[model samples]
Target: MLKPIKRAVHFDFHTMPGVDDFGENFDASLFARQMKDAHVEYINFFGRCNIGWSYYPTKVGYPYPGLNGKNILGDVVRECHKLGIQVTGYLNAGVHHEALLRHPEWSKVNMKGETVDLDPQKPFNGNFFRMPCYNTGYADHLLAEIRELLDLDVDGIFCDCMLLRPCLCPNCTKEMLARGMDLSDEKQVTDFAEEQRRKMIRRIRETVPEDKYLFINSLPCPLTKDVATHAELECLPTADGYDRFVSQVALARPLYDTVVYMNGRFQCCWADFGGYKGKAAIENDFYDAIMNGASTCLGDHLHPNGMPEADIYRDLKEIYAKIEAYEPWTDGTRFQPEIAVLSTVPKLNQSHYGVGRILGELNYAFDILMPDGDFSKYPVLILPDEITVSGELREKLNIYLKQGGKILSTGTSGLMPDGSGFALPQWDFAYKGKDPMQIAYYKPTFEEKDLIHLPWECYEPGILLDASEEDTVFARHITTYFNPGYDGTHFNFYMPPKGETGHVAAVMNRGKNVIQVSFPLFKAYMKTFTKAHRILMKHLLAELIPQKQILTEDLPITARATLTKGEDYTLLHVKATYPEIRGTMGVIEEHNVLPAGRTVAVKGEFSSACLLPDGTPLVIADCAGYTKITLPEITGYAMICLK
Candidate 1:
């Protein structure tokens, strides 16, 4: 789902040679023409990033106050905008030790209560950066400087810091309290951060055009950028990135898809996926993001210490050749579901039954979304075997449903609240009839208009393919294998062979809409038949309020996408991970050149033989078709010209 149509390169010109001793000899007009010639879509002029400094003039504050005439941002923006290359100047929100020294009151106190300076002692130990108090006078001053770019008709604003993770400072705590929240709990603190970030985005939105983007470099706390045109995350490969998983970094993909399905505002990711040596790994990470949802401004920093190396730039050019083709993958189907199901979550229903699997395999259509209240955003609410919604939320659900909105509650959906730790214990009691904790309960009625009566039972080695209306299923072509001769089937429900009873699973239909429910855990069950994530998705498409689901195959899996095509051609991504397991990968042939090897293997999976622009191949994982291909490499992705 990480495939994105729009991309921006962070031009870290910090170490670029000055035009003159007073910042002149660097040939301004000439370089602007050079940037336009680069054919780049967007370039964020590094006015100030990486630490306490400014590339442009500022009357409010100045570290290099002695600098004389020429200003960098003004020159770049003026030249680039005329050449059709959008420009957004950068501002290091945090990270320079020198800035902290200049604005002592703006500095942050760590857990040790020590003030940190953004500009550290010259040698650099990474210790100087700290989270500052946002409600302070310094932030106001910073905002004032940022205001200058808006006057220049900048395409967007690049905020280097101010993350979705909140600061535990006094101002932050006070603000949280004022917002009907607390700072003690982690989620609450996170919520507070998200809320504040949202406000930041709102402010930026208020400042620019609806199409302008905002790059909030906060990682874990990135949802605030949800409402912006596009958002950015920083340093996924760096020390503070998605802990280096680059692939599984979580955010608003699951939760926000309901609103901005594809090419929506929730598009953002940290460009910081560190350095790449090979053309393969580089293409791998790049396309993997495209397949998932977004690839906005991925950090391809050529140097660690700002020393731009020739070899690294070569790699960037090669990778860029491949990444540029991400546009084609952006035009497909859009999946905006309503009834989001809660998964193997730590909290949920405590008293259901059975050692269960196959909710989706059962052909149930439960919206695969991250439930974050925005539940109100959806008209009807469906609760399946997962767990019960909190009492307060349950009460809200009851109200919404009673008001004529349908509520699909099955299994032990409403058995109890979260405080009791009702997740597994309760679920086991309902599905299995007995738990080691001696928990037990009557199974939920499979009785519904959509489900037909069929004698079904689970198997030892394989799970059930028990899904209904197969035509509607999506990309269930999972190469994720369970080492052959793998003992123990996940869940196989013996069916009555062929009948209406055999086809339908649990379904809730309102005269207005129908919601299908399913539980397909491919990791637990090795058999592909048992995965009904698609059968349910079909229901989401035709029944649960019109949704256009795009799939490379007919079965559904953890990997999914929403592409905005035809109109502008963009791809939005949402991805998840599987338990430790690998499967045979698939490689599709594109391009005129066919290599000698049977296929390229990425992280062990055979690659799709499509030639990326730079000749690197597009390799998709066997498991869930996780993949990446250079956008320019594939001719199929070329923009179709209508007569």
Candidate 2:
């Protein structure tokens, strides 16, 4: 098997044809030395960029006009090899501008009979805007380029922009017709495109040796797990933010043995020259990767002059050096989650993002699971908004519930395939279609009313549920006076609550293990970021699984905590640096040093507790069923190990 990537760099070199000084100051030895200095174990260099310009002299493709005769790809591979660093040649598989321009017939034609492009208005704005059909001769040309990269003795091939996009090109249409698939049906066209993409991936995987790495980017991780050697989560925090990365890591960890979290050094996003993120922000990304049992791959764009920004390497050296120190503890550790959230879809969606963010903020260790995931492993399973329980999945859930597994479902989750009622008999409530009111209010029971503001406005519509006599109503729904709309002469800016409707908003069955919330709380929380929504979720989760794995005292809501288990020890990671929203981006420039009064109570019987790497012993005390440890003053991030 190929070795796992610990610390890697994704060097993007997508230069347009008009660049005059492309690779003019190219120094392969200097580039390798810089990467080695930053403690990079693997480097993904460019073999063929999206602009359809090969970095080196190629027999099958167009070389960069400014390269003249210099074989930059070959030189970098040979130099990086001398430093014991692995390398992967990157090829833009989907969007090849030069190739599409050369052979316009290879371009994918959409249903509108227009070529598939990112922006229909600006057809020639960017190199990546135009997409080429994979079923055409372009596939053969791409494979020939891959063969050239393999002959260069690189470690592997990394194919970018490998997405399944529906096409109506002549080649695709002919293939669909031959297969007796209806070209008019959108689903059939999409399925055919998926098959074509997969066929190409299979060919590439077959060509690559078993010992070499192969990564197909832009596809769902589970769909490509068998063909792709490892999972690369390409999430740039500045553009995509932290929630997407967190959710993707949770989804990818269980499928692949080696998962690499790819973030960029750019302040904004990819290909931003002279843009740099703060040291603390980059450190947080790397720490998040290791804490979640994944490797790190920092992204950087090579300047058109073929020189790397010296400051990027300087920051990486400090951050990666810290990661290297903690590798012994994090190398093979697995996440120890106390809860599993049954995802509404196979891919990452708003529900997953909301649940993951809320759970992380609440200091709860959880995993995002598919419908077929092992629900018995977690103490509680969450069916987020709109999880359709098929017969097979319902059987699995029933078995899990019988084995004392708790379930917290919201919105339309747990509904029957026909949407008649709840699939699980334990949920003693009748689903009475969706409420007509677009904006409703939630009122907690008297006992829990002080938790948050009563009559909390729900921005989105929710399902109406009638709880059975055996069910305990925890919260009631309050109807609005009227939805915010113009009624001829009168217009309302916001909907005002019109007294309680006596309908159940949140309820628990007699078993006390199954709790159901009528509203689409996950989606509402994601879209509105309402504190009440998260508060209600936290309260319900506590009621479901009262004995949590990790409990914190005096920890701020902005801080995040996670638990991972090694062979001989359990690791607790705490991060306190919160990103501040500036303009359109979340920027993290400063680290918050928490005071020393904070304490963490872990539900385990470990004999000793100590800080990681430095081996600083902490004060540990044993409670009835938990171990309480007084943490040291933490700045940005800290890890504790219990044995």
Candidate 3:
């Protein structure tokens, strides 16, 4: 098995030209010492930046003019090697400003037959302004740079910005035409672009040694898992918050042997030199990664002077000290999820984010899975929002269902690829077309009325379905009096619920193992955190899964709980820190503590129960095939072990 990256730092150095005094104040020994103090075991130093300038003296690429004759990359590599810290050479593969300026023919042309370049008005706004076409001579230039980094004796290569940007360059156009592909078709162009990227990855994988690590950023997991050594999820919470990170981690954990969660140290995002996320937020990010079965990597931009930031390392030292203490329990543990959510695509969508957030907030242990992922292990599988059941996947799911697997499918999940009808016979519903009323309301049945009393408004539309006579209806669809829209007369601002349409919104089969909801509840819940949606989901889960992994009482909705199993024990991780929305940014300034007297019940019996790291014993009892324990006051994070 490959060794997981526990503590690492990604040092970004995308410096522009005309910068003077580069590497003038660099002390190789001091830099290594600072990393050692911060407990960093691995580092990704800049080899070739987005500006197409190498930090080391190179023959294949232009050296940074500010470097003047200093081989900063080599010096840092030697120093970090002496301290047993592994180093990977970083290279910006897609965007090369200097190369594009020197060779205009290598630039990527878009569908409009126009050369893709940075906005002339805001050229310096982002680093990915001008991208080079891989089908051109730029591919050879990129490969030559990788060889140079290998010759420099770096431990590995970290290639960045390797996304699929469809190009219409002469070479790409010729190749597509030769393959009889229609350039006008968007899907064809996208597939061709993905093939080009896969070719580049294969070439890079061949260049790097099998033993050495090679990570390609922005490559979708399980699709490109064969070309890379491991997976790295780069998520800056300030920009998109923790939902994306959590969803990506859940998708990658089951596929890769080693997965690293990379988050920035900057308060806003990358390249914010004056910004810092402070100790509490950093702790929250790191612990969240660890509990989700991924190692942590902090993102920081190195100063042009080549010296480490003193204040950032100081804060890192304090935060990493706690991580080091908790490593014993988290080192080789595997996430124990009771439910598997089938992901519609390699890249996560709104449905993925919504389902992940709802499951996480509800303290239900679940993992995001691909269509081909194993389904037999999980007691219940969720097809969220937009998953179309393919023929091969339909066969696999049929076997799983025959073996007593429960499924909760929503919206267009169980539908056939052609939208004819549901592929699964267990659904027990006939698919009519989409509802004409885009927005409607949901009314629960009399039996489940206590869960949600009144009609809840659904902003998204649902598929029209007619349930079989044997099916049990949990909720009914209630159309709106009229969709809020301008009718060329007076505009309708208010929409009230009309009478029930006698059509089922949520239904279950006679076996009670398969439940299907007509609407896209997960996406709606993610867009609008409606309490009734979550309540309805919880009610559905009660019927699907009678015994949950972790049951909590008196716990705040903000708190998150995950279960993991180690060699000798089962660990229940609980995190209680909530991010405060401050002017468009979610900030965590302080850790909130939950008072004692909260109770938790873990499924299965254990010999003993105690708190992690400290080994403090907790009172435990057996209740209905579950081991119940009373949790002490927990601040920030807590791990309970049952062995």
CA error at residue 433 for candidate 1, angstroms = 12
**All models: lDDT?**
0.40, 0.85, 0.85
Cα deviation at 368, candidate 3, in Å, is: 1.7
Q: Between the candidate structures 1 and 2, which one is better when assessed by lDDT?
A: 2
Using TM-score as the yardstick, the better of models 1 and 3 is 3
Clashes of each: 89, 0, 0
Question: How does residue 368 of candidate 1 score in lDDT?
Answer: 31
Q: Rank order by TM-score, top first?
A: 3, 2, 1
Model 2 stretches with alpha carbons more than 4 Å out:
116-125, 178-185, 446-450
Candidate 2 lDDT, 491-548, residue by residue in tens: 9776678888878899998888889888888888889888888778877888988788
- On TM-score, the candidate that comes out on top is 3
lDDT digits (tens) for residues 545-633 of candidate 1: 33323232322232222332234322323222222212332112222222222221112123343332233433334544333222222
> Can you list the residue pairs that collide in candidate 3?
none
Q: What is candidate 2's local distance difference test score?
A: 0.85
Overall local distance difference test of candidate 3: 0.85
Residue-level error in angstroms, candidate 2, position 514: 1.6
